[model samples]
Target chain A: MKIKTLNLALAASMAWGTAASAQTEIEWWHAFTGRLGELLAAQVEKFNESQSDYRVVASHKGNYSEALNAGIAAFRAGEQPHLLQVFEVGTATMMSATGAVKPVYEVMEESGLEFDPEAYIPAVTGYYTNSDGQMLSFPYNSSTQVLYVNRDKLEEAGIDPDVDLSIWENWDEVLTQLKDAGVTCPYTTSWQSWVHLESFSAYHDVPFATNANGFEGLDTELVFNGDIQVKHIDQLGEWAQEGKFIYNGRRNEAGANFRAGDCALFTESSAGYAGVKAEADFDFDIRHLPYWDAVDAAPQNTIIGGASVWIMEGHTDEEYTAVAAFLNFLSSPEVQAQWHQDTGYLPITNAAGKLTEEQGFYDENPGTEIAGLQMTRNEPTDNSKGLRLGGFDQIRTIIDEELEGVWSGQKSAQVALDSAVERGNQLLRRFEQANR
Target chain B: MEKRVIFKGWMLPALLLMPQIVITAIFFFYPAGQAIWQSMFVPDPFGLKTQFVGLGNFEYLLNDPYYRASFLTTAIFSTLVTVVSMGVALYLAILADRLIKGSGTYRTLLIWPYAVAPAVAGVLWMFMFNTRVGVVSWYLGLLGYDWNHVLNEAEAMGLVVAASSWGRISYNFLFFLAGLQAIPRSVIEAAAIDGAKFWTRFRTIVWPLLSPVTFFLMVVNVVYAFFETFGVIHTITSGGPQQATTILVYKVYSDGFVGQDLGSSAAQSVILLFVVGVLTVIQFKFIERRVHY
Candidate 1:
């Protein structure tokens, strides 16, 4: 009996020995492809090589919407990954998933990791925090909207390549000049609702929806049909009629038109820089997103539009510790600076920005700092802080549909905006009922 | 005279039917039953909380104007797809039937498109008619005719229908060709001997004999248009340019999956199921009357 007991103890120790040698594996499902995806993989590899305690495996599930859907379905099937990268639009949906996700604060605290929520930039962190002012998710790749100017196209049109397009008035004149210069596609935009309405409202210090743009409560109502939004859209409708502004598809599909040198101006995400840099053979510059001169607080601040990493529940405490360590490694100043400089995403921490500046990276890249400066130019107002609403993706679709009506000359801007608000309110009500 | 099979032992027949019943119950009835059950309750995103709201989802959907508009869109979309695909397929099949040589080559070339997925077909069509950088659109622009489906409702609807029908024509052609080849040549010769031209012969004899195949293809095509062509619509137009192409199935998918509104999505599914059921029954009772067989 004594010999048998000793043998069993020896067997248990040997099993643990093999386990200790093999690092813990933490599955991370993200929604980035191309350059961003490669950068993410590199970050994971560096983290893995720097430590022997854990191995972080990063997988590209699909695009933003697909990845979020995969995570939700996986969680329901009791096989969710350790971490999920959810896009900015899905923030509200992720926040309301109660027990399905472990808050970042809780994860860090439980893992006994040294985490300071204040170390992150407020504008980036505020979007992913709870009502109690605790960070819920780790902001990874955040970007704000910016205007991309094809300088070569501008010069070809006989307009100044350094034209000031910071305001709608200046853009209107530039567009008219470009149109008269035989430019068929003078100006086009990607993410019409994002650049034209959502960020536009925030940049002009106007409420996109009530309840602080749905950040305060679930009972938020659609209020984007106010005078400011109507005027801006009305002006765009006139431009559409004049062949100055072209209406592309709902998503970032117009990036192709701009990158191919077929369009002179493009309002797209800051992260679009990578594609433009890679594809365009012409000179291009990044400009601040234009604002309306009629508004009292024009160009207040632009909000972010990118994904954040969330820790999924149903993992061991040991795995949670690994996740914390991995996120910490990702959030380090050197890593964040490299990611920001390479990807054109905003550095999530001020320390990273300072580090990048100290390294003279921004000075070398010229226009690379516009996105961060635009995001932090002024303190964010109630309207400027990022929108947090359920059914936001659907609402954006409705806005796209209604705006298409205006572009096609089927309905006036007022009528289209009014109809969109009515339709969007119904969706919001449905979402509120379900979540409440 | 109608032929009937008589079973001597009930056990043998029951056992034979058992597989089909089990398959249907497992594959169809089980998930459908769950959808119906879920339609009555609204669940939060996490499924952590749910509220029983019997008949509320249905009532809301009925009152919603966009849902009603989508009903009309689906009706128009399905009709166009069915007619366009079947009409083109019948024409091609007749042409192939007339050809003496290279008929096999033509049929094989026509059958190649059916292998492409619906989403892939959509992308192919979208590229041809894309607003910018499209070969066809550029030619059209050169001809002083602009084609922008991104903002044009009619163009958006036309693009999706063309794509959906383009992929489906191959399936319809296969059936129509088989049906056309099965028609006895002696009958056509006899009709020709009766002083009938090609159009007259086709109208009187060919169409009548092809009714059974036509009826089967009609039902199959309608079901395909209702359920399967969502990938085409989703990829090309996304039911967009002001919901002009927002068919019933796409709405159900967008609402349930993208919006995460499980109750509304389930309700839409139940309504779609009822629509397909009623449509099938109506086609049999109404359309099958003209079938001579």
Candidate 2:
């Protein structure tokens, strides 16, 4: 009886060993949870099913910031996965990690895959590419800032559903109208610095920082306290004081109020479409991010906000090949179109946009095309391409503090912006010194 | 007069002390030493290269206004958390002790919150005070109070202190209750027979007897507020509404993990270690003085 049991255990062990060794495993750590995580898992399942030689295993490693930390810690422990998903703000940090990352261009070239850099949207890929015009990471999910309007709330507030919110002057009038109509929170914004400041600078074709928004060199100084930027922030501060604008917690905490149909207008990432569409019972419309008419030819373009997948170092060449194949599968037109349509993230590739258009997916979803159009509206200027500043996340926190000062009525817009610039410059100097 | 059981041979003593020494070296001293070593060097985010900055990181921290502000924030936050939590816990412990019939039931109910994670407790309090949907905020709004912590620094600090204290009250309650129950019944009865009022008995007898427990809990609660309440601050405000609640530990995390400034973060940790050390020393001195009484 003992011999029989031992033989059965040995047979089971042999079977498991063969099954596991039959396919090479690719570990992918991502920040996405909820519906996005489900979609990522589904995509990985399809990839694994399509190719029996390689199995891609995807893991949710907390939020964007936490996932980036996990990757760094894992790399230090020499146990990093084959791929890591990092938010856009960490682009500079990832690029500066010299030997810690394997650029996507190198991965594709080494895998002998027919890779075309032009297949992706310039604006989407531009944010993740190096100065040499080489792609550093796969633009997995990119979102541009856009305005969300509750049409029902607008009608109730005695305002036109089609009221032009394209320019700040019109937006100001609308906000006042809503306030006069007794709306408590007529306007609130998510990602204040991103939508109001970063995208604001880019849309007005103004430099947020010197050195072409930190792309030219690391010795960049914050120039976001520019006249136009100050003018816009000053208006928001005035509105805040007047109770027309509600100050929500930093990030998308205000999205809840807007989705609850309490706030009439929300300036948030276009990706908020997924949540707003699901939760909001009111009829809503997506519009271009409001611009300052004071600038020459207003609304240049809004920069990206979501994350991209970067290939980490210390993975075997075999694993790199697997990662490249997985990336290719992800970027396929059909898959990209489906992902874009499902998640409201802008399609990374022009082919996916065209495919979605040809399939009438955008036609069915009227507001979905706005994000893509907003990103590709014009040839991106040096200022509008994207920010690539080391220690950008820290700078954003500093910006949040100063902006909070304005909202809390503690300081004027100019004072807050000036402080933000001075503090942000110090961090920039520190980052430069550390890296050098 | 101290009880002594000195081992006759050095070999046996070393063997007996081996486990504790190993644990301290591995769990405490080693990582702390690493942090101290790393504090003197700045590494690029990729960890490919590092430069010896000597005391550069510490000097920068001392000069950085935000870092200094965080130190003050930590001081205010820990004090508020320790006092509020211990005060409430002691009050509840006394009430539970007075309830002779179902004291165990009340004790169990009060202790349940300690089982909750600090982050979860933060979320729970956050939900109750959330500007849009929070019951407390909505009620306050109806009363024309306009409870908006997102923009209100005082309210933000209040919310974090409440959340941090709420979780710790359960822990403090357990200790206070144990101390209360450990008191001799005859002594309290004799005080009652002497016509001493409840407040007077508690003040003169129960309070002095509870001092040791109180002192121990103060140290534990201070450390808890300093280190363990990071989750509470992170979840409730992300240390914001203008860094009103950006405590020292949260800054260490934000700078180290989120900002990826390892050298600065390590330096912050080293300074924090020094602060904790000084606090512990002061606490021990106070405890020694109280012990003589």
The C-alpha local distance difference test score for the whole of candidate 2 amounts to 0.91
Off by over 4 Å in 1: A1-22, B1-5
Candidate 2 lDDT score at position B268: 96
Backbone collisions counted per model: 0, 0
DockQ for all candidate structures vs. native: 0.70, 0.77
Give i-RMS (Å) per prediction.
Answer: 1.0, 1.1
lDDT of 2 by residue, A180-285 (tens): 9999899999999999999899988999999889888899999999888898899899999998999887899999999999999999998999899899999998
In the range A285-373, model 1's lDDT, one tens digit per residue, is: 98889897767798799889888999999999989999999989988999999999999899998999999999999888777899999
CA lDDT of each candidate?
Answer: 0.91, 0.91
For candidate 1, give the DockQ: 0.70
Q: Give a tens-digit lDDT track for model 1, residues B1-293.
A: 99998999799999999999999999999999999999999998678789999999999999998999999999999999999999999999999999999988999999889999999999999999989878989999999999999888899999999999997898999999999889999999999999999999999999999999899999999999999999999999999988999999999999987888899999999999999999999999999999987
